[model samples]
Target: MVALDGPSGTGKTTVARKLADRLSAGYLDTGAMYRMVTLAVLRAGIDPADAAAVAGLADGVDLEIGTSPQRPGFRLGGEDVSAEIRGPEVTKAVSPVSAVPHVRELLVARQRRIIAEVLGEVGGIVVEGRDIGTVVVPDSPLKVFLTASADVRAARRSSQDTAAGRQSTVADARESVERRDRLDSSRTASPLRAAEDAVPVDTSELSIDQVIVALCELASHRGLLAGCSAEAAR
Candidate 1:
């Protein structure tokens, strides 16, 4: 198993998906699970700050998460909400909603179950989120913490938002990223942090392919690329 942990705007989701595809492994965007709950909370008109209420709501939410890197899907109560969970509304509320102790406990259990199932079925899986390495899968064979400069991360976020049809500015993106960083890093339950054994990768000057190649090399060295093709392991 591989654990990719990083804050928003660090390209964790894209990198994790691509890496899983290259390695022929399953992928899990644990953040999307939290976002799904956040969307559910918002749709119910519940305050995100109300941890008790959010936990109660999350308890009964029927969330189905797909592990396919090529076609990940998130369904809430039989409603496909993959795109809705990425919108600004859920992005803004997800941190607080996920911060709830019960919510984290619930989702972490589900995440572990999914990981175990995927590992049994596929023999490998790449899981990405704010706390994957530190909380979700600390014993993963490989753990990577991706990082980039603030300005670069903000620009990347702005470009992504614009590409997704959301009106965004660099300034606004920077503020949102910074705010999320603060909230995630300061959360008492399973805070955003790198595991002690995690490898740190600074992506400020590396393209996506370069980052993937670097991770592939790390995996190869760690014996995690046993069945991967030579081209992919290169």
Candidate 2:
């Protein structure tokens, strides 16, 4: 398994999907699991700041996540909620839900099981999340901590909102990213941090293709690729 750990707006999701495609491996976005839980909490009218309530709700919610990079689907309570989980309310609530110790424990176990399934079926998998390397898969042979400057990340988020026909200023985006960073990094349970053995990749000045090429090269150097020529050349 390839563990890609990073904070929000760092392109972890996009980079992980492309890397999985290049390696012909399955992709797991653990963050989506947390987001699904957040959506469920909102629907149930639970207070996001109430750790006990959120943890209790998360314990019973049924979550299904697709490993295929080309068709990643997220379901909560047997309902397809891939798009719903990405809405503003869910995004706002995910940090608190993720902060709950029991919630993280529950989701981390589920993530590991999903990883095993992907490994058995595809022979390899790339998993991305805030704590994947540190807590979820610390033994992963290849651990990458993708990072970028706050300004760059905020700008990217603004661009994304614009593309989606939402008006978001860079200033607001920056504040949001910073606030999330503080919450995630300070959380007591499985905080956002790079593992000791992880290789930090700064993507502040890199393009999507550049980051992918670099990651492929790193994977090749670590002898994780079946054939570097065929995989990296793509």
Candidate 3:
């Protein structure tokens, strides 16, 4: 399996999706898993800090990522939650909930199972999240740890938040990005960092296409490219 780990606004989701499409491999968005769980915790009126309650809440919910030839989407308990999970409300609260050990354990277990399923069916998967490479699937053959300068990532976040109408000014989105960066990098449970075996890429000055090209090349080098007919490679 392939594991791409990185923090928010670093383009982990987009890059993983594109790489999966290119290789004809299944994709899993683990961040969506965390966001869905956080939404559940919030909707249930349970504090994220309550580890037992969060773990219990996770038990009663079924979280899985849906995949196809085009890309992957989020499904929580058989409901398509792709759109709802990306709202400003969920984004604002996901980090704290995601940092909790119970929440991470729940999501990581689900993530590993999904990866295993995809691997059994298709030989591998492209799974992206903060802890995918290091903690979720440490033995993955292809491990990528994506990164970008803080300012560039902040700009990306500002653009996304602006398009979503979550912020009026780029500055506001940048601030949100900074705050999230701190929380993600400092969290105790599977904090965002490169795994010892990861291939690090600084995308601060690179285009989306460039980043995907690098990841695709790296995957090919590692013999993780799927659906690569010999004649086609020739």
Candidate 4:
């Protein structure tokens, strides 16, 4: 398994997908899973701070996340909710829902099981999230912690929202990103910290392709891929 841990707007999801494709491995966006749980909590009219209630909801819901990079499906209770989980509502609610201790415990277990299943069936899997390296998969041989300047991340996020017609300003995006960083890092449950052995990549000045190449090199250096370093050089 490969663990890619990073905060929002750092291109964790995109990079994880590309890495999976490059390595011919399965991909899992743990963030999307959290978003789906947040969506369920909101739809059920449960308070975001109600940890016990949210945990119960998370435990009760059945999530099926696809590992295909080209067709990653996020389903909740057997319903396809890929688009719904990425909307503004779930975006705002996910931090608190993910902060809940029991919720993380339940989802982390599910994530581990999925990783094991994918490893058995597909040989490898790349899983991305804030706490994947530190909490979910500490033993993953290749753990990457991606980072970018706050300004760069905010601009990137604003551009994404613009493309999606979300009407977000750069200033607002910066605030949201900062807020999420604070919440994710301060949360008592599996807080967002890079594992001690994780390779850190500062992506503030790099393009998505460049970051992917760096990660590919790291994997190659660690002997995860036989010729990934040469492929990255090319």
Candidate 5:
């Protein structure tokens, strides 16, 4: 397993997918699990602040995750709301809802199963999120802590979340990312943190491709990608 933990940007999602492609491994979008739980609680008409209700909602709902593009499943209460869970409202509130102990336990178990299934095959998985390296898969073969300045991360967030070429104001994006950073770090359960042995990759001054090259080199040097295929020559 390759645990790619990072803040909002730093290209963790894109880089993890590309790394998985190069190594012929699977990719786990762990953030989506949190979003799924948030969406479920909201749709169930349960107040997110009520921990017991949320826990019951979590138990009652089923989260099925598949990586296939056409039918990526994040079903809740027998309804598929994969796309809805990724929208702006859930995006902003997920951290708070996910911070709850019961919710994190539920989602973390699911995440472990997701990674375990991929491990059953010869191909490993590249798991990406805020806490993957520190908590979700602490024993992953290769752990990377990707980071960049908050300004850079917020700029990237604005670009991706906006429609067309327009974006939320830079300040708006910065505040959003900062709030998430604070909440992620302050949370009691599986907080976002770099694992003790993780290699920190600061991408504030690096291009996406440059970061990819660096990670690929690290992977090879660590022998994680020694016999891998599906890569294009650098």
Candidate 6:
């Protein structure tokens, strides 16, 4: 298994998907799972800061996540919410909702189950999130903690938002990213941090393709790319 953990705007989503594709493995975006719960909290009109209320809502929410690297899906109560979870409303509220301890407990259990299932079926899986290496899959064969400069991450986030039809400025994106970093790193439950054994890759000056190549090399070095061809693994 491969655990890709990092803060927002570091290209975790894109790199995880592409790396999974290259390795012919399943992919799980654990962040999207949290976003699904955050959306449910918003839809119920519950305050995200109200930990008890949000945890109660999360306990009963039916979340279904797809593991396909090519087309992973997020469903909330049988409705496809893949795109909706990426909106600004969810983005703004997700940090608080995800910080709740019970919510993390619930999702971490589900994530472990999904990871086991995918590993059994596909022989490998790439899981990405804020705490995957440190909390979700501590024994993963390969763990990567991706990082980038705040300015570069903010610019990437702005471009991503604009491309997705969301209006955002670099300044706004920087504030949002930094806010999330503070909240995620300071959260009491399974905080955002790199595991001691995780490989750190600074992506401030590297392209997405370069990051993927570096991870692929790491996986290969760890003997995790058993079936992949030499060219694809590198």
Please write out the lDDT profile of model 5 over residues 144-232, one tens digit for every residue.
99999989998888887775344587788899889988988998988888899999999999887777777877787788777442243
Question: Against the hidden reference, what TM-scores do the models get?
Answer: 0.97, 0.97, 0.89, 0.97, 0.90, 0.97
RMSD of each: 1.2, 1.2, 2.8, 1.1, 2.5, 1.3
Alpha-carbon shift of residue 160 in model 6 (angstroms): 0.7
The regions of model 6 sitting more than 4 angstroms off are: 227-229
Model 3 scores what on Cα lDDT?
Answer: 0.79
What lDDT tens digits, residue by residue, belong to model 4 across residues 1-234?
789998899999888898888778899999998998999999999998898899888878888899898788998989999988988888888999999988888889999998999999989999999988888888899999999999999999999899988899999999999999999999988888889999899989998788888888788778897676566556
Runs of candidate 1 exceeding 4 Å displacement: 227-229
In model 5, the runs with Cα more than 4 Å from the true position are 68-73, 77-80, 164-167, 227-233
Quote model 3's TM-score: 0.89
Instruction: Kindly list the per-residue Cα lDDT of model 6 for residues 1-234, writing each as its tens digit.
Output: 899999999999999999899888999999999999999999999999999999998989999999999999899999999999999999999999999999999999999999999999998899999999888889887889999999999999999999999999999999999999999999999989999999999999988777777887788788878644465535
lDDT, candidate 3, 95-174, per-residue tens = 88888787788778777777788878987678888887789989889888888877777788878767766664667767
Query: How accurate locally, in lDDT, is each candidate?
Result: 0.92, 0.89, 0.79, 0.89, 0.79, 0.92
Global fold similarity of model 6 (TM-score): 0.97
Which 10 consecutive residues of model 4 have the lowest summed lDDT?
225-234
lDDT score of model 1?
A: 0.92
Where's the lowest-lDDT run of ten residues in candidate 3?
A: 225-234
Better of 2 and 6 by lDDT: 6
Q: Please provide, for model 1 over 196-222, each residue's C-alpha lDDT reduced to its tens digit, 9 standing for 90 to 100.
A: 999999999998888888888889889
Which residue segments of model 3 deviate by more than 4 Å? 69-71, 226-234
Residue 155 in model 6: lDDT: 99
Query: Quick one: ranking by lDDT, best first?
Result: 6, 1, 2, 4, 5, 3
